[model samples]
Target: MSSGDFSLGDFVQRALPLAILGLALIGAPLLIFEPEGLPRMRALSKELAQVKAENVELTRDVAHLRAEVLDLKDNPTAVERIARGKLGLVRKSEVVFQFGKGR
Candidate 1:
């Protein structure tokens, strides 16, 4: 209540919050508007989304492969179909007519 009677505890109590607030105000702009700060955050966010999409695509691919594996394991016809289609296999009595050879 008296002039020039400031106590140490009162000065510290008042100055501490001001110091913290000053640091926050100064640090916020340095982190938000600085070229390497906000841009890096944005770039990382974009990369995270892209990676998530790729992970989804990979998960779908893995599911398709797993289904194919199940088919190949449980079904004999599936293996025969694949062999015939991909390897150009035919039954012993089947005829293969090549209409577009060396054209």
Candidate 2:
């Protein structure tokens, strides 16, 4: 081994750090600035959170509607209440009164 001659081991130790550093310098900007990078990931995360919240709200609405349907199906008074309030219905024996509009 001569002092003036460079060995393969010495060459690798010198070149490896420069190679890794060069790759990092080139790759960091691509990760930050590319369309499919950090920005896309953040956008998708926000969309997922919104969708999950909507799903929770819809689930609650479905539960409430199911209970109302069950009540209407089993309770006659509930049915009559809805019919009277929404359809302007009355019993057959009920009397009616009419008044003229006053100016």
Candidate 3:
């Protein structure tokens, strides 16, 4: 309590505000601009958005593939189309035509 004595209570009263202010000064910019803070959050948000878009596209592709699979399983015409296009299969009664030069 003497005028020349350093006191814990007095130090806390004076230094706490400065410490709090300094921390805020250092922390506010991190919240706004630092790569591990706001910037990283924004990057993650952008990545999530991209992943969601890709998921939608993949969902559509999966649906289309499923429908095609069902068609190939049940629709004779679809089976024939795939066989002719992918496997080069022909009906027994169909004539084979070759116009290109043989390798």
Candidate 4:
């Protein structure tokens, strides 16, 4: 066909594919990288990082408590003091008296 004889059918066929491609290009970024999509991923990443940090802190605390437990186990004086106060044990020379509001 001649350039001046461009028909509506030919224009629509060319324009439809271009319109669909344009819409796909525009919508792809919104679907993949828009705030609604990316913000949740970013928030999850931050939460994962915080949870990892808390895990590390809890691990350190557990290690410290384990060390303290080992120290108490190895020390007789510490064990004796804990037993005397917590278990209410007394030596042979110590006087045992009960003078309290309940008694």
Candidate 5:
């Protein structure tokens, strides 16, 4: 009860068990409430963050596509250029020629 009666060994014996019990109490949440552990939680959190980042990137891409669609609707030249490049279209007077390298 008194410090005078407690030897160093006695003090350590009492303190060590109390310290272990305190650590166990502090660790209970990390053991039970967490699905796996701190590492698993960190990995899941990182995955969620990456997904959210990719979602943001995809949303930006959609916005860019919408702007391009609006531009194509308002500009006939842009539509023609896209069609000419992507679909290989040509005007009535345009000549189509193919030269083979094996000649």
Candidate 6:
């Protein structure tokens, strides 16, 4: 083949690398900077971690509430304590006292 006689194979071999390089240059920045790319993925991962932590905390709170509900259901003393503490309730013939704040 003569030097000037460029065939399809020659064009393909020469242009393929340039095409690949051009695509890389254009795509690399898009991958890094695009809204749906690495940055968004990282943000989503952080949000997922935060959501998972919140879920765990909520799960703990739910368990605590369930246990408290069970305790209030099964334990008569718990009910009495809440009633007396929150409601200032007293039984019949119970004496009551009041005091002002002291200096």
- The lDDT per prediction is 0.94, 0.95, 0.94, 0.91, 0.91, 0.95
RMSD of each: 3.1, 3.9, 3.7, 5.4, 8.1, 4.0
Note the residue pairs that clash in candidate 6. none
Where does model 3 exceed 4 Å of error?
A: 1-18, 101-103
Question: Model 6 over residues 1-103: C-alpha lDDT tens digits?
Answer: 7799879998999999999999999999988898989889899999999999999999999999999999999999999999999999998899988999999
Model 5 misplaced regions, further than 4 Å: 1-35
Which lDDT tens digits does candidate 4 get at residues 1-103?
8888989999999999999999999998898787778788899899999999999999999999998799798998888888899999988899988988874
Report the number of the highest-TM-score candidate: 1
Better of 2 and 4 by TM-score: 2
Q: Which stretches of model 6 miss by more than 4 angstroms? A: 1-25
Instruction: Report the C-alpha lDDT of model 5 over 1-103, residue by residue, as the tens digit.
Output: 6857868898899999999999999898769667687778888999999999999999999999999999999999999999899999998999999888985
- Model 2 RMSD in Å is 3.9
Per-residue lDDT tens digits of candidate 2, residues 1-103? 8899999999999999999999999999998879999899999999999999999999999999999999999999999999989998989998878899998
Clashing pairs in 3: none
Name the runs in model 2 displaced over 4 angstroms: 1-25, 98-102
CA lDDT, candidate 2, residue 100: 93
lDDT of 1 at 60: 100
Model 2 TM-score? 0.64
Residue 9 in model 6: lDDT: 93
- Cα lDDT, model 3, residue 71: 93
- Best-first order by lDDT: 6, 2, 1, 3, 5, 4
Question: Candidate 4: what lDDT?
Answer: 0.91
